[model samples]
Target: MNREERIRSLLDRIRSASLDAHGFVTELELQDFRKNLLVQRGVGMSLLMASECVVQLEAFSPDFVAEHPEIPWAMIRGMRNRMAHGYFDIDLNYVFQTAKHEVPDLVRIVETLLHIHPQGE
Candidate 1:
C-alpha cells in the first residue's frame, strides 16, 4: 500500500477502536476502568489507538499540517507524546472525555482527509 493508503488504514483502525470503546462504555463494561482508573480500559485503549493514528499520519505525511492548516498538528503530537510517555500519570477522566467528545471530531477530520486524498495502490 501507498502512504496515503497506509494512513487511511490507520485512521480506519483508530475509528474502529474508538467505536469499540464507545460500545464498551455504552454497555457499562468498564467497572474496572471506573474503579481502578478514573476512566475505563476501553477508553484508554481508544486514546492509544487515536494517538497511534496521529503518529502514523505524521509519519506518512509530515506536511499534512501544512496541507491542512486547519488541523492541530502540534496539539495532536503533544497528546501522542503524553499518551506515550506519561502512561502512569494519565488522567482517566480526560481520556474518557476525549473519547466521548474529541474522537468524533478526529474521525470527521480523518474522513475528510481520506476523501480529499484518495488512497491508491
Candidate 2:
C-alpha cells in the first residue's frame, strides 16, 4: 500500500491492539502477565504488534513525527526496537505499563492526527 494507506492500516492495527489491552488492569495484568506463560506470550505479542504499528507511523517521514510534538514518537519507536531485538530479555513490567496506559494514549494521539490530517497532509 501507499504511504497514506499504509499509515491508515497501521493506525487501525494500533487501535485494535490498544482496545484489546483494555481487558487488563495494571496490577492484575502485571501479575497475570508475569505468572502465566500463556498470558505472558499473548500480552507480549500484542505489545509487540502495537509497538510495530507505532514504528510504522514513523515511516511517513520525520516531518510527520515532528509535527506532533505532543506524541512520544521516539519513545514509542524505542520501545518497539528494544522489544523486537531483546525479545528474550523483555521487561514484563514495561509490557504491562504499555498495555495499561501507553497504547490507549498512542491510539488517541494517532486518531487525532488522522482526524486533523485525513490525507496525512
In the order shown, the candidates' Cα RMSDs to the true structure are 3.4, 2.9
lDDT of all the models against the reference? 0.67, 0.73
Candidate 2 local lDDT, 1-119, one digit each (tens): 78667766777787777666644544564666678776666667776787787777777566666767887777777887887899899888888887777767777876886676576
Range of the 10 consecutive residues with the lowest summed lDDT in candidate 2: 21-30
Model 1, range 9-113, lDDT digits (tens) per residue?
Answer: 876776677676565555443344467543465577666776677677777777754677666666767776887888788776666666666766776776776
TM-score per model over all chains: 0.72, 0.77
Global local distance difference test of model 2: 0.73
- Runs in model 1 deviating more than 4 A are 26-33, 36-39, 117-121
Best by TM-score: 2
| Over 4 Å off, model 2 | 1-3, 24-29, 117-121
User: Model 1: which residue pairs collide?
Assistant: 33-40
